[model samples]
Target: MALRETDPPEVGGYRIEDRLGSGGMGVVYLARSASGRRLALKVVHAQYADDDEFRTRFRREVAAARQVSGAFTAPVVDADADAPRPWMATLYIPGEDLGTHVRRHGPLPLPKVRELAAGLAEALRDIHRAGMVHRDLKPANVMLAEDGPRVIDFGISRATEFAAQEVLTQTGRVMGTPPYMSPEQFSSPQDVGPAADVFSLGSVVAYAATGHGPFDSPSPYETAVRVVDGDAELDDVPPELLPFIRLCLEKHPKSRPTPDELLLLLRDGHVPEPRPLPTPAAEETRPVRRPKRRRRLWLATALGAALLTAVTATTVAVTGGDETAPGDLPTGWQAWHKSSKDPSVDKEPVGPSNPFNRCAATGRSLVCAGDDVMATRFALADGRNTWARPIDETADDLGASTGGTIIAAHSGRVYVYGADDRPIGHDGMSLTRYTVQALEAESGKVIWKTVTGDGPAASEPGTDSIAIPAGVVATYGDESQYYALLGADDGKVRWKRPLPDPDEQPCMLRGAAGHAYLICTLYTGSDITGTSVTQLAPTTGRPSWTVKAKGGDLDLVGQTDGRLVLVGWTGNHRTVTLINAKSHVLTTVRLSPAQPEEASVHLVDRTLYFILEGGSVRAVDPSTGRQLWKTDSTVERSSRPTASGTRLYLASPSGRLAAIDLRTGKVVATSPGRDDGTLLDTPSYVNAPPVLVGDALYVAYGRRSVYTVDVRDL
Candidate 1:
C-alpha cells in the first residue's frame, strides 16, 4: 500500500507538503524554504530522535555538504543536520535517478553516454577537491536534468544513521551495495577516498552503457568477493572506453587518477571554470546514530536480491575475457594513423613537449606537425614514413614552425622559401640557422624558405604555414608579434596585426570562416584562468570576432565547407564551437562531463563526433545542436580519425585500421590494437592517430613502432 502525504509534526518553520520518500533512518518530504524555494527535507526517524550520538553524526553530515557545493552537485538550501530529529534540506532537482532513467529509456544514446561521463568526472572532481568522499556513489544518486546531470543525495548516511547500518551483515560488519562498492570499500572503508568513488563510477558507467554492473555476481557474497578479489566483468563496455574504466577501477588507489587528473585525461576541449578548491572540511559524512543490527541485515538482503541470478550469468558471459593483449581489435573497427607521441625515439618526449599532434588531410595522405619536431608525413595507404625532417626547436625560431601548411595536398608539389636571400644562421655565425622551408611531397626537397628572427629565440621553428590555393601564406608569430602574416608568392608581407596577450600562453593560428583566426588562452588571474578563443583576419591580424574558449591550448581541426570549428576547455567541460566568420556568428556546443565512462571528440564536415572514453561514437550536428547517430568500436587511445568521401577511418593503437560508416557511425571493418604499457608513465605511446593514404592506414604503436593496416574491407 502507498503511504499518503501528510504534514510533518514540525521543522524549523516550513510545513511539509508531501512525503517524497522514506528510508530506514529518516523520512524525506517536499518542504518549502523561508522564501518558498522547494526543498527535499529529510527528518530522522522518531526512534533515533532521543540519541545524542545520532545528532552529532547528523551535524557532521550537514557540515560536509556545506563545504562542497557547486554546479555539478545539488546545492544545499537549509539543513539542521544536528536537530533533535536530525533534519536537512537540499534543492530538489526534477528528474529521475540514473536507475529509473535507464529502466525507462533503456541504455543512453552514445552522445548522452559521453555527456554523462564528462559531467560525472567533473562532479567527482568537485566532490574530491572538497576533501570528502561520496562513500555511496550509485545510479540512484544521479539526477539527469535537461540542462545536464546533477549529483544529489549527499550526506544521507550521516543524517539517517540507518543507511550505514542497513548495509551491514549479521556479523556486525558494514557493506555497500555489492555491485557499486569499490574493492577498497569492501576491504578497507577507512582507507577509501576519491578513488573509491572512481570505482563506483566505473560501475555506474558499466550500468549506463550495458544495463549491468561491472561485477554483477550471482549473490551478494559473491559480488563482494569479486569486488575485493576478482577482475571487473566488463563485457558490455565498448572497447574504446575500457582503458578509461580500467584506470578508474585500478585496485591500487595510487594507480587511479584524482578527479582533476581524470578530467585532464578525458577531455579534448575547454573548461569553463576552475574547479574551486575543496573546503578544508570533509565533503561526505555518514550517519552513525541509527540502529546497526537491522540496518545491516536489510542492506545485505537488498543487495542480494538486486544481484539476480540471470543478470550475473549475462554479465560474466559478456566481459569474461582478458582484453589487455596488444594487437587486439574489435570486429568491424577501422584504424586512424597519426600519433601524438614519437614511436621511433624510443624515449618519450621529455616534457609535455607536445600535448597533441596537429593534423590535416588532402588528396590521399595525412600530414602532421608537433612541437620540437619537423613536419612528417606517412602514406595513408600504408603505415610507412614518407619523410621526416627536423625543424628548429629554439624558443623564437621561425624556421622551426610549420603551422599546418607544409605540403599542398590539393595542388601540385611546390616548395616554400624566402624570396630574398638573408643569412639563415643566427647572428650570421657558422651555425646555419635554417629558414622556414616548404618541400615537395614526393621529392622531399625544399621548395621555399623564409628567414625569421635571430639568437636563441630565432633558433626555434615557427608553426605550420597555410598555403591557400591562391598562393597566399598564412603563418603565426611568437610573443613579440601577434599578427599572423600572409605573404604573397613574391614573399612580401601583406598585413600584420597585434594579438592579445592574456596569460601569455602559446597561441595557435587556426582557419575558420574561410579566413585565418587566432586562438589563445587569456588568464584573468581569477578562478577561471583556462583557455579562450578569438577569431582574426588571416592577413591583417584583426579580430573578426572573439569568444572565450576553454583549455590550456588550442588546435585548428579544419574548415568544413566554411564553418570555423575550434575546441577548448572550460573547467572540466569541453566546449566545441562552430563560428561563421563571414556572418560573425558562433554556435557553442558543450560536451557533458565524461564520468566513470570515457570519450573523445572529433569534428568531421561540421558533424561533431563524441567518441566515448569507451569506444562508442556519436555524431552530432553542431549547427542544429542535435545528435545525428552513434556507433560502438574497440576501446583504445592514440587512435587518429581520417575521412574518405563519406566514410570515416579509425586506427586502433594495437595495429588495426578500420573503416566506419559516417552516416551511421558504425564500424564496417577493423585491424588490431597494440598493447604497450612500457611508457604508461612516459609520454611515448605506440598507438596514436592513424594516417590514411588512399586505401592504407598507417599505425604507430608505443614500443612496437609503426605499422600499416589495409582498408580492403571498407
Candidate 2:
C-alpha cells in the first residue's frame, strides 16, 4: 500500500514525517522520535506484511541489525515485527548511496575506490564476524556516510539459523536486485553466506571505480547470466587492485578471501583512508557555500551588477595571480639560480654537454650523457650547470657512473668527469675518441683509457670490465686479457691475468668495487644457459672467484657497499641475484614468473627496485634476498620507477604517478595525470625514470612540459 499523508496515526510512538522514498516492498518515511532523533521508517506494504513467511524474514533482519548496529552500520532505533504494517526504524544515514554517487560523479578515482574497497571489507567483516549474512546486500542498502560507509536496510538479511524450507524459499524466490546479485544468490541463494555479501561489495566497488557493474549487460537477464556463467567485466579497474578483487569474486565462495583476509590485502596495498563521518548538519545538506536565501539574493544582485559593469569596463585590467610559482627547496636539493627551463642555445658552452637526455644520480650529483655531447655533471641539489667537454659525437651508448669518476664506453668515447664534471683528458690508441674513458677523483686529468681489438663489436662497454679506483684502472677485453695498473701519473704496473679461453665471448660487466665483476656465460655449444659472475681483483687483475648466479638475460647494476645486485630474467621466471663482492656469496630472490623481458634495476641505498616489461614494479632487499612489494603501474610498458629516501614513485605512461610507501607496500596517493589525454597517447619509445631530488619529483614528458609534483602533498 502507498504511504499517504494520513495513513498512519503513529509508528511505534513517533508520527510519520513524510514519504522519503519507496521501493517495491515498502515505503520509507522521514520520521522523528518523541525526543527528535531522525529516522528512516521502512514500513512493509500491507500485502507483504500479512505474509507469515515474509514477517519471519523481516524479524530475522531486525535481529541482525540490532546485532551489528554501530558506527559502521545503521543502528536500529525501533521496530515492530508483529505490527499491522510490520515496520523497521533505522537511525537515518545521511549522504548519497554508492549508486547515486556514481551516477552523479561518474567513476571515482582509483584512490577513492581503494578506500571504498577497504572500508566495505571491514564492514563486511564486522557483520560476518557477528554471524549474520546480508543476503540482499546491494548499493541501495549502503549509505555513503561521512565517517566511512554504513550498511543499511537489512530487511532480507539473515543469520546461520537456517531451515531447509526457509533456505529453499530464499533460494528460488527473486530475492535480490538482479543488477547487484551474486551468482549463488541468483542460481542457489540457499548456499549464500558472508561471501555473497563480499560478491555484492565487489560489484559496488566496481561500479564506483568505473560507472558500470562488474557483470554489466545490455539487459538485466544478460547481466544475471554473466554473473552466473561468465567472467566479470573488470576492464576499467586499476591493474594493481584487479588481482585482489578477482580473488574476491572467485566462482567458489570458499575460494574467495574472507573479510579478514581482504583487510590484510588492502592493508598491504595501502588503501586510501575512509572519508570522515558526516555530522548531522552536514548530512542534511549537500555541501553549500552560503545560506540558501542569501545565495539567491547574491546571485540576483551579481547578475544586475555584471550587466551594468560590462559596457563601461570594456578594457579589463587582469591582475596576474602568482599561484604557479616554483616551491621552496626540497630537502637534499641544492638552491639553484639558473632558469629551470632549457638552457641558452646560443652560448658556445665548452666541455661535453649532455642536455635534454636521461640522467642518473651518484651520491648527490647527476651524471647524464647525451648525443653529440660529452657526459655532464650537475649538483643534484640545485641543478647547477657543471663542467662539460666534448666526447665523440658518434657515440650512442651511455652508462651511468657508479662512484663518480668512471664513464662506460658508448659508440666510441668513454668520457670521464671529475666530481665537478670537468673533463680531465682522453687516452687510447687510434680509437682514443672511441674507447671508454676513466679519470681520477682529486684532479681533472685523464688516468687510463682502452681500445680493445677491433672487430664486430658485441655490445658497448663489453661485459663490465673497467673498475676505476683511487690510483688504478682495470680493463678486461675480448682477448681474455686483464690489466690492472697505475696510469700516466704513477706509471707502475699493479697486476695482470688472462682467462681460460681468449676466444670466449667478452665478459658482460656485472659490477665492481676494488674488484671488477663480469657475468660470463659459458656456452656448452647447445642451448643458451650456464651463466656465472666472474670476480677479478682490480690490483692484481687476476680471477678472485666465480659465483653461480641465475642464468638468462640479466642486467647487472653496480655493487653497493659490498653486494652485487643482478636482475636476472629467464623465460617465464624473473630472479634478482645478490652476490657479496668480497666473499662471492650468492643469494637469488625470484620476482614475477611472468617472463624474461626488457627490464631495469635501480638501487636507492639499500632497497633494490625493478620494472618488468608490462610496467609492473617489484622492490626487493638484496641483503636478505626477500621480495618487498610488487605493483602493476599500467602507465606505459617502458616507464621506469624511481626512488628517493623511503618513497618509491611510478608514473604510468600517461603521467599518472603512484607514490608508494616503501615500508608498508601501500599506495599513499596518486596524481591525476596529464591534462591532455591525447598527448600521453602519443607513443614514444624513450622511457625516462622519475628524478627524485628530495621531496619534489621532477619528470619530463612529451617535448615541452616538465612537471614537478610534491611528494609531501601526496
Q: Once superposed on the true structure, which residue ranges of model 2 sit more than 4 Å away at CA?
A: 1-365, 377-390, 393-432, 438-459, 462-468, 471-506, 512-514, 527-529, 549-567, 574-608, 620-627, 637-640, 651-658, 669-710
Candidate 2 on 287-403: residue-level lDDT in tens?
111111101111122222321000000000000011111122233553332312222222442322112234433233344433333344444455554544334422222222122
lDDT of 1: 0.52
Candidate 1 positional error at 323, Å:
41
Off by over 4 Å in 1: 1-388, 392-408, 414-435, 456-480, 486-492, 502-507, 520-534, 544-562, 572-578, 587-599, 612-616, 629-631, 674-688, 700-710
lDDT of 1 by residue, 1-714 (tens): 133655454487876777777765667888776777888777777777776766776677777777775588887777774566667788887778898889888988756876787788888887777766777778888889877888876665434433344322211124356689876665445566677888888788778887777776433433553464345656556654554566667655545656665565456322222233324263223211111111111112223232211111111101111111112221232454444333223133343233223333322334444433445554444435566544433333333232222322322133332211124546743233434555444435555555543333232333334443123334424333434343423334556565455345556655432244566665655454544556544434566576654445455555554566665432232455665645646676655432112445566545666664446666767655566776676644435465544567665544445567877777777765553443343324323355433334444444324555544544
Q: Deviation in angstroms for 593 in model 1?
A: 8.7
Estimate every model's Cα lDDT from 0 to 1.
0.52, 0.52
User: For every model shown, what is its TM-score relative to the native structure?
Assistant: 0.40, 0.39
Q: How well does candidate 1 score on lDDT at residue 193?
A: 66
Which TM-score value belongs to model 2?
0.39
Once model 1 is optimally superposed onto the true structure by TM-score, how far is the C-alpha of residue 143 displaced, in angstroms? 58
